[model samples]
Target: MSIVQETPIYRFGDFTLDVTNRELRLGEKRLELNARYFDALALLVREHGRLVAKERFFEEVWADVVVSDSALTQGIKAIRRVLGDDAANPRFIQTVPRHGYRFIAGVSTVARDDTAPLPDGEAAGSPDAASTPATPAAGEAFPSPTRLADRGAAALATALATALAGTLGGAVAGLFGGLLYGFGLAHAPPDPQPGTASILLVLITLSGFLGTMGGFGVGAGIAAAEYAAGGRAAWRIAGAVLGGMLVGGSVKLLGVDAFNLLFGRTPAGITGGMEGAALGLAVGLGAHLGGGFEASPWWRPVAAAAATGAACGVLIVLAGGHLLGGSLDLLARSFAESRLQLDAIGHFFGEVRFGPTTRMVLAAIEGLLFASCVVGALVAARRPRNGLPA
Candidate 1:
């Protein structure tokens, strides 16, 4: 003969999971859930707040069986389906990246004695009159991917896109600035010499490298926002763009200020911080708004192009003043040897002249180049895959 007892119940929100009977109920109604899923949910609820590693899931849920990872994923998906939880925006379970899962909701426990029956007037199907239900927290909970490898791949692609954009932005700035410098030289009365041209080429290349770094900061911000806050398309894009601008601007202004403070000299000039902030702001806004598609489009080539172009344009304008200075040593050597015949070089060095007209021209050229390259790359990448919107 065997004696049966009422099981202990674990309560969270409106659901009560009875371990003794292996039943889960909402209010007075019982919900049909698979035993395996129930086991996984029970474990999650038990360890609430702490991440349950995948290895532990196998040991505890599958009893150390060499099961595929898909088993755990299916179990989790089933649990979410029953709970009406969104994996993109979870209300109960949160997936820990590269790890297992965590139960974020609060829980309480109740124990019942089966030996003692209820009072004559009490009903078994009614809500638990003896227990006080803890008030569940307001709003939906965050959800992440059950698979780490998938998210990791997305992260890598986002990172690569940002880096490439930054580098391209820098290259555009340098190339245009060099062109403007050469154009200004061409109109001068004296013909420019080889040494001056070589020096300017090196200076232009250096400018491109620096511009690339500045653009990279904005890219990082966009990626971080997307990964951290999963939201509606508008919210994600807005948040990402805003975050990118803030980060980009901060990178430019603060970096320059730091160098000035440390060196006891302002190498970027009095307006360097202002220039950096402007560049950062433009990059963020252009990149976020350029796509003009849904708030959260599957593809973002247009936006990338716009952002890269915007960043390149701003940097090229700000970097115009650096053209002649960068080539000073080479110019000096050439001048000493009488190898530089251009009177324009002498005037440029003496006056430290960089005109606004030239800067605007450079901006237009660099911006166009950046936009074309980024857009082309994005379109090409998407072409092979079918069903994507044009």
Candidate 2:
């Protein structure tokens, strides 16, 4: 019998681990994973189905960083979920009471040509000491230790780009909205309080618009990161947006109540909680459905716009009953008693009612914002420099 050394590529069950690309593919679909989890997986595979101790994982994976055993537990759970393995009757990974884990599945080293073309434009340099002898398919090459670092860099870059794109989009929207209201272009306020009215309105409008833009952009950035990490773009977008809204809403509710209790002043309207929950549901559904247009380059933007507009309508109606027939008495009362200086507070409080034209404009703004989010996400998700292995 001849001894075969370890290889960068491994095939076990229906999964293919392209260590070079740092990806785990099931046939054609690529599974999403974090860098740390992948590192732990690669270590286990390298050990050739042998038991990997918890202490060893900490030394290698964590590298002096203090963490609890739960981190490892979570990583194992994530691996199982991706591999569709059950803890009770495990197939791939089996836990040893309190000792460690063992890779029970059979692993085969994939033959490869180290001199083949690298995916990320790296030169097909000489193979290192770890190179194993084998005949791999065309375009397959062994991944170096630097592959993990490169993947991490790519993730960071994507996040930064998404955040920048979102900030720019929000700033533009704020400038436009602020100019319109500041110059007396929009509906005039009910009680224009002297020389400070326009300045106050512009500042307040810019602040609120910027806040909304920032929040949505952060959500979109999260979705963009998810897509960059090989997740389904549509589902990620919807999930990220909905999750962000719900969280933000919850914090807002608690913060408002806390502030009111501390200072004896209401910070939010009565329907604020309802508005957040409802808006979260509506926006999430809209993003989820609009993601279907991803295949069509032209219709994708249109879908995003439509979804945004719909979400906006729902939000407006939920917030203060501006779109449909609903009472705004609570909102009005909150505004009257609250000390907060908000832009167009009268309109929100039902003092300056929104006509059909005003409502349509608001909806259009929402649509534009949604479209901007799509653009931001796509911009960050541009063809990755180091694409998945062929």
Candidate 1 lDDT over residue span 296-356, tens digit each: 2424645565556555565655665222233333343333554433346335434433235
User: Model 1 off-target regions past 4 Å?
Assistant: 1-149, 179-190, 230-273, 292-353, 363-390
Each candidate structure's TM-score, on Cα atoms with residue i matched to residue i, is 0.40, 0.45
- lDDT of candidate 2 at residue 353, scale 0 to 100: 48
Q: In model 2, what is the error at residue 210, expressed in angstroms?
A: 5.3
10 residues in a row with least lDDT, candidate 1: 134-143
> Per-residue lDDT for 87 in model 1?
82
Weakest lDDT window of 10 consecutive positions for candidate 2: 121-130
| lDDT for model 1 | 0.50
